[model samples]
Target: MSFVSEFRSFIAKGNVVDLAVGIIIGGAFTGIVNSLVNDVVMPVVSVVVGGIDFSNYFFPLNSAVTATTLDAAKEQGAVFAYGKFLTVIINFLILAWIIFLMVKGVNKLRAAEEKKPVEAAPAPPPADIALLSEIRDLLKNR
Candidate 1:
């Protein structure tokens, strides 16, 4: 096959299409996960922990940097931004947990499907085949 044909065939493969779709869906899912962590979960967590904003949590490396927020501190000088890192870690953990639950649920469904009992006996032969068999048996007797 020519290069163009080979390339087309590769792209047309089921796994390649599935992977492309997965990547697109994953990108959209990342946005949803980010929003959940930043808007919903973080706010609830902030309330529980007395309204502390993790994004602004950082240690200024330079003595000259006196800004409170991480962004402002970075504007002034370098800072160790552990709070942002913590938030990202939390987001990753939540996303991983959700994916794990989804996979577990799918596996359970597959197992249940597989466990369903199959038909114990095979179906009877077609009419013509049964008639042929009867004639064959009669010839053998003669």
Candidate 2:
């Protein structure tokens, strides 16, 4: 087969289809986790901690920079964004944990499926055994 045909075949394979589905699902899952962290978790954290806002949680390297919020600092052309980096790290950890749990669940289901016993077909009597039975019947007839 030509290169193009071979490539098309590879893409149409079951593993490739499964991988595409996984990527789509993973994207959707990421959106959910992002919403949870930004809306639910951050709001609660803001209420409890009272002063720690991950978005605004940055140290201004430039002493001349007098911006109250990280965004404002960035707007004024400031550098060194530790807060955004920290938030990204936290988000990555949460996403990884959720994905890990999902994979673990899938693995468990696969294992259970594999553990199911497969029934075998019954074996037929050998030709020699059949012939012996025929000979016995013939002797009885005699």
- Top TM-score model: 1
Total clashes in model 1, counting residue pairs 3 or more apart in sequence or in different chains: 0
Which residue runs of candidate 1 sit more than 4 Å off their true CA positions?
Answer: 119-122, 126-142
Q: What lDDT tens digits, residue by residue, belong to model 1 across residues 1-142? A: 9999999999999999999998999899999999999999988988999999988999988899999888889999999999989899999999999999999999999999999998789889999999999999999999
Worst 10 residues of 1 by lDDT: 116-125
The pairs that clash in candidate 2 are: none
Per-residue alpha-carbon lDDT of candidate 2 for residues 42-70, written as tens digits (9 for 90 to 100): 77877898858878877777777789888
RMSD of every candidate to native, in Å, equals 5.0, 6.1
Model 2 global lDDT (CA atoms, 0 to 1)? 0.84
Q: Please report the candidate that would top lDDT against the real structure.
A: 1
Which window of ten consecutive residues has the lowest lDDT sum in model 2? 78-87
Task: State the lDDT at 93 in candidate 1.
Answer: 98
